[model samples]
Target: MLCQDSAFRLYLDRCRRHKFGLTEAQLPDGTHNEQDARDWICAACSIESRAELDHNLEAWQTFRAIRNRFNRWRARGGA
Candidate 1:
């Protein structure tokens, strides 16, 4: 996933702020194409219920944690 992408980053920020409205389950699955990243942002922008917001936050948290770890590893030359 392109976490650095503006749209994707916005989605992540929205999720962090506890906003969510996506109907489809678009949680990260270790691999994401550009379309998947765009879909995630679209979902964030369309969130319409408390349940979906909560789900988004949960998924985003997990995704962020994993991404952070990967970034740290890469920084340490794990790439």
Candidate 2:
């Protein structure tokens, strides 16, 4: 699943740190953990869960768009 992918998880961490400007101390529990990333992904994609990306075409497309944007940012050395 997308949520279980190591690379994607790392990207999420970077996104929170760089793109979102969120530090661990700034998070609710002083941690930018897996659940936080999953929550962010769900919120960003307007889906209830990461599993939805597998069966929901719209959610998958939205996730892809997000990933593409993140990749572009990374390519430009934004992370």
Cα error, residue 22 of model 1, in Å, equals 38
Model 2: pairs clashing at backbone N, Cα or C within 3 Å? none
Per-model CA lDDT versus the true structure: 0.49, 0.71
**How many clashes show up in model 1?**
2
- The candidate that wins on lDDT is 2
RMSD of each: 12.2, 4.2
Which tens-of-lDDT digit does each residue in 1-79 have in candidate 1? 3544544444444343444554324443234455655565445446443245356876566556656755665576544
Taking all chains together, each candidate's TM-score versus the true structure is 0.34, 0.59
Task: Give candidate 1's whole-model lDDT.
Answer: 0.49
Q: How many residue pairs clash in each candidate?
A: 2, 0
